[model samples]
Structure formats: structure tokens, C-alpha cells
Target: MNNLDKVKKIVIEKPLKLDCGKTISNFPLAYETYGKLNEKKDNAILAFHALTGDQFVTGINPITNKNGWWSYLVGPDKPVDTNKFFVICANVIGGCIGSYGPNTIDPITKKKLATNFPVITINDMVNAQINLIDFFKIDKLFSVMGGSMGGMQVLQFVANFPNRTKTAIPIACTASHSAQNIALNELGRQAIMADVNWNKGDYLNSECSPDKGLSVARMAAHITYLSKKGLQEKFGRKLQERDDLKFSFDADFQIESYLRHQGSVFVDRFDANSYLYITRAMDYFDLVKQYNGNLSNAFKESKAKFFIISFTSDWLYPTSENKEIVIALNAAGANVGFIEINSDKGHDSFLLDVPEFLKSIKNFLDANYKIL
Candidate 1:
């Protein structure tokens, strides 16, 4: 078996008290690693995944039979360069993929937690990751990197554990979700719960698992991931399958067909309850609140070098949001660098094959990180 095939499964028992006042025991964190940790354990890099992403970072996901989510940016010679740095990617605490999620069987009830799974926040996810790092005996991380919700975790990590990281990179993310963004997430949740099969999020044993509702939720959110120009260019008035519009309920526009496919495929690989939990966690995130309402105070004691990147077209969390983070870091006297990649791909550009994005990362790591 290759290295990816030798993947190990680890489950960290949750502590009695979580940051959110929840008692979660037997918390499982599913993760995978590429390359090897050096003797000093100084070469470790923690790669945080976005809202819908799982532990599969640079290899194929055996569960879904699909390529890893961020494979474009993480291989042997890619920007992350697994050949040198030991990369660790884990599904967040409320995630479904092998992690203890709403879908996991609760030892007490002998059934999946489903809707009973305690509410989790972004801080809870980062705290779980900190536990994993502690288990690995990695006292400090060489770098912590991510985008979107992943980027939120990156910032949370630095704020919560300033001494544990050497470098921090949060891409295309905001310190807190805007009211409009929160409203969008709420609508998605409402769509899922609106399905009669939802049964208050306890639909694991139902005949059909709210697939339609989840599909609609995914479709709605996926629209936010792309730039308006990208959507227009990729599929505007173009008809789907047929040259002429049916003008009925059938999908006529190519975008509708594309979104339908996205929704259908997403349902197959993701759990609706997990989606609800993760999105709620993201919506509850506000890093500045823990810092006396001063965003800069969040990084007052940080020693990590910071790299914040944003895309011009990502209105979901535009460049201005990134600048706010950069400004705070600067006010705190933290060493920081900011870059805005000019792209029409919107928030998803970082995950796609963007040469300049990769180059920026490569150059940053080469110049600052020591290779041992």
C-alpha cells in the first residue's frame, strides 16, 4: 500500500468540559498526514479544511471515491509541498467523515446523535484540533493555513493559542460572518428542516434522507461560492441537454442543471445534520468577542508571522474583510503580509488551479520557514 493507503484512524476522547459548556466524551477526530514529522517535530503544518471539506487534503478520499478537496495546492511539488513539510488535515469536530458527528453512533443511546448532537462552535473545532496536535506531541506548528471557514479556524487558533504557531495564513475569510451571510446560512438550514422527512434533524432511518431539501440547500450556498461573472461565463442563458427551453419545471438553463448536479452529488457524500451543525458553528463564530471587542486584541500576544490573502471578486468575504484582519494584526505589532489575488473565480479561486496563488505560498514558505 502507498502512504495514503496506510492512513491511520485516531479518535481523541473529549474532555469533560468544552469551551461551549458542553460535555462531549469519546470525541473522534478523523485525520490524515502526508510526509513525515522530523525529529524536532518542527516541520509540522496544520491544514484546516473549509466548511464542506473533510480530512482528505492531498490524496483520494476512499469514502467518496473522489480526489481530495485541496489536491491542487498540496502535493509533493505543490505550494504546500508535502515532500518537505509534514501536513495534517482533519475533518472538523462537527464533520461527518469518520469524525464523531451527528451521524456517529452515540454509545449512550446506541444510535446516531442526529439532532441531539450538542451545538458546536468554531472555537470548539479549533480546540479539538489542538487536542490532536497535543496527542501528536507537537508543541508548536510551523504553520496553520486555510480559507473560508478554514480561515476562520486559522485566526481562532492564533488568537487562542498564540505560542503554538509560528505562521498563520487565513485566505478569503472574515473575522465574523456578515448579517447577510448569516441570513444565507439560515435559509439553507430552513430549507433542510422544511422537508417533512427532516423530523427535527433525526432522519437517519427515514426512507429518503431529505435529499431534496439538502440538495436545495447546497445549490443555494454553491451560488455564493462563484463570482457572478464566472456563472455568467460558464453558463448563462445556455439550455441544458436541449437547445430550446422547456419553460416548465424541468431544468432549462445550464446553471440549473449544474446546481442540480452539485446538490445531488453533495447529498451522496455529506450528511444533512452535519451540514446544519457546521454551518451553525460558522455562524456563531466571532473571534473579536473574546478579545474585549477589539479585533487587534485578539492577536495582542501572538508571535506568529501572518499572511492574509483575499480575492477581489469574493464578495462572500471580500478583500476588505481581509484588510480588516491585516489592520488588526498590524496594530498589535504582529508581523504580517497581505495579498489580494485578482480573479473572477470568487471565494473558490484558492481551491482551484491558480498558479499565482500557489506561487505566493511557495515563495512565502521558502523565504521564512527553515528546512531541516
Candidate 2:
């Protein structure tokens, strides 16, 4: 938080009316960029971040001292090949990493917005980031891509601004949030609220934080990111530095320790309130309903080419959901391609080092860019 001002950002002078009927103005939208935008500016690619992911897509994240979440893909000579394309990523409006969110202080009140922050939707997030496009004076983006919640934003972006991008890649995401996923998110939310320290999402001014509850939430959600096969192969019933169980409540298996470590580290870099607001936005996403049950209508106006990708083992979004988008694109007569990469890594496969998956993206972007 002390280094927040150090993050690159722009203050949007235009008022943004959120889906919850609240209007926000003069808010900061933090972002990070890679490579350079050529004279034509057609080399620009907008990359969206998933849940809990900030704008740091590649290289070292100065805030956490860890590798950026997408370091494996979006770098010089990598799949995205920032050397050839200028990649732009922004912290979604409901995000905590220097973006306007619950942790952001109200300039008027001089207090953290906290629970007073109005709920935002995926549509609102895309609308807020569009200001960045205008700020840079890019007439049309070369590409827009993301996975999971990031993918949802890609869909929303195209729907809102059909002529803004040349290509769209929505990987491992759905047009609408499924009931099961909503329930899973609710489970995480309950864990946070159960912590007395949460204090109804107004704990910013307090000394104690709801770290225990947040850690448990992360542990539970992390399981969904992996496949049963992947988990078995990686951890199995392996004991954690012991020949036998400790016979107590402490972590006895390697898997337990792994989950605890993930949860603990996540709490350090993330704000609990941001997690709550972002998940709620994901749940409220329903592109089909927005178009009156015809998902095809969502993209009917977009001439941009689309490429949807999915993993074989991703049960969270699953191949079915990704295919649905392809099907809708087909119905709309939009130029679209679909691929299901074989992987045991589950929903997080897109974020990992999967050669075939990376290669496909490179081929798509490179081939498309050449045509331009």
C-alpha cells in the first residue's frame, strides 16, 4: 500500500455509472505495459487479469517480490511475444492493486471506502479500462486476451466496443457464471465474514485482520484450480517431513502444507474486501441474459476474430463452457476458432508452462498480425 503511488495509473475524469446505480468519478485505474506501441499503434494487445491477479503480467512484481502471474507467456520472444506486441494490463476497478476499490480512500470523505464501496460488475470493469484505450489514442487494439475471470472481461469488452479490437481470445471461461461456481465463491465469502475481525468488511482501520478466514478461503479455492489427477500425482498421501502423521490438527500431509502456504501468501498481497467485491462481480456476470438469452447477440456486432481455448481437465470452467462461446460465435457468423489442449493441470493450466497451449496462442497471434 505504501508503494501504491509508485504504480502506473490514470485518473478517469469521466463519471462511470456502475451496475449497482452508483457513479464514480476521478478514480485511478492502475496498469502496467510491456514492449512498445508502434507508430501505427495497431500492435497493442489488451491483457486482462483473473481473480486476485493484479496488473503485473510479466517480469517481477515489485509489490510482492515474486514473478508476475503470467511471466510464462507475456514476455519478450514468448508466446505473446511482447517484442512484437505492446501488451497492456490493468487492475480491474474492484481490484486492490492501486485501482479504485474498497481499499481506496474516498477523496471526499478521506476514509477507506470499505463496505461503502458500491458493487461493480464485469461490464463496469471493462468500461473503466476502456478509458485507458482512449487515453493512449489507439484506434483499434491488435488483440484482447485473458483466461478465467479475465476471459469474462474479454467477452464483455468486445460486446461493449465491437470495433475496438482486431482479435479476441477468451480462454477457460464462461459467458455466464454457473451455479456451482457461485456456491464455491459464496463458501469463500462466508469464511471471510465468519472472522470476527472482518467487522462487516470495515476492518481497514483495525489492527487485526481476518487472515485466518482468508487463508481458509484461499485453501478451499486452490483445490478447484487443480485436477484430481494432478493433485494425486503431485502430493498424493505423502507425509510432510514425517514418517507418520503427527496425530494432531497440524498439517500432516504435503498437500495440507501446500494449501496453507498458498493461503498465507495470498492474504499478504491481497485485500480481503477486494476479494469479496471481485467474486461478486464474477457471479453477477451473465452475457447471455444481457442479450436476452441469445449469447450470439453479444458478439453479433463485433467483426473481430475470436479464438477460444480450454483444457481437458479444467472442471471449473470446463471445455463445455468454452465450447459454448464457440458455438455462439458460430451462430453469430463470427470468425472463431476453438481448441481443447490436453492437460492434467485443470483450470490453472492456462497460467502454467504448457508448450502446446503456448504454441497455439503464438501461432494465432503471429498469423493474425502478419495478415495486418
Candidate 1: TM-score? 0.96
Task: State in Å the error of residue 270, model 1.
Answer: 0.3
On the 0 to 100 scale, the lDDT of residue 111 in model 1 is: 81
Residue 296 C-alpha lDDT in model 2? 99
- Tens digits of lDDT, candidate 2, 177-278: 999999999999999999999999889988888998898889889999999999999999999999998889898999999999999999998888998999
Residue 54, model 1: lDDT of 85
The models' CA-based lDDT, in order, is 0.87, 0.95
Per-residue C-alpha lDDT of model 1 across residues 1-372, encoded as one tens digit per residue = 023334455667757355668777666788888888999898899999998998888777887777898899887888888888999988887887777778778787888889888889888888888888988899999999999999999999999899998999999999988888899899899989998888888788666788888999999999999999999999978998897877798998899989999999999888899989999998988887777789999999999999999998898999998899999999999999999998889889989988888889888887778541
What TM-score quantifies how close candidate 2 is to the native fold?
A: 0.99
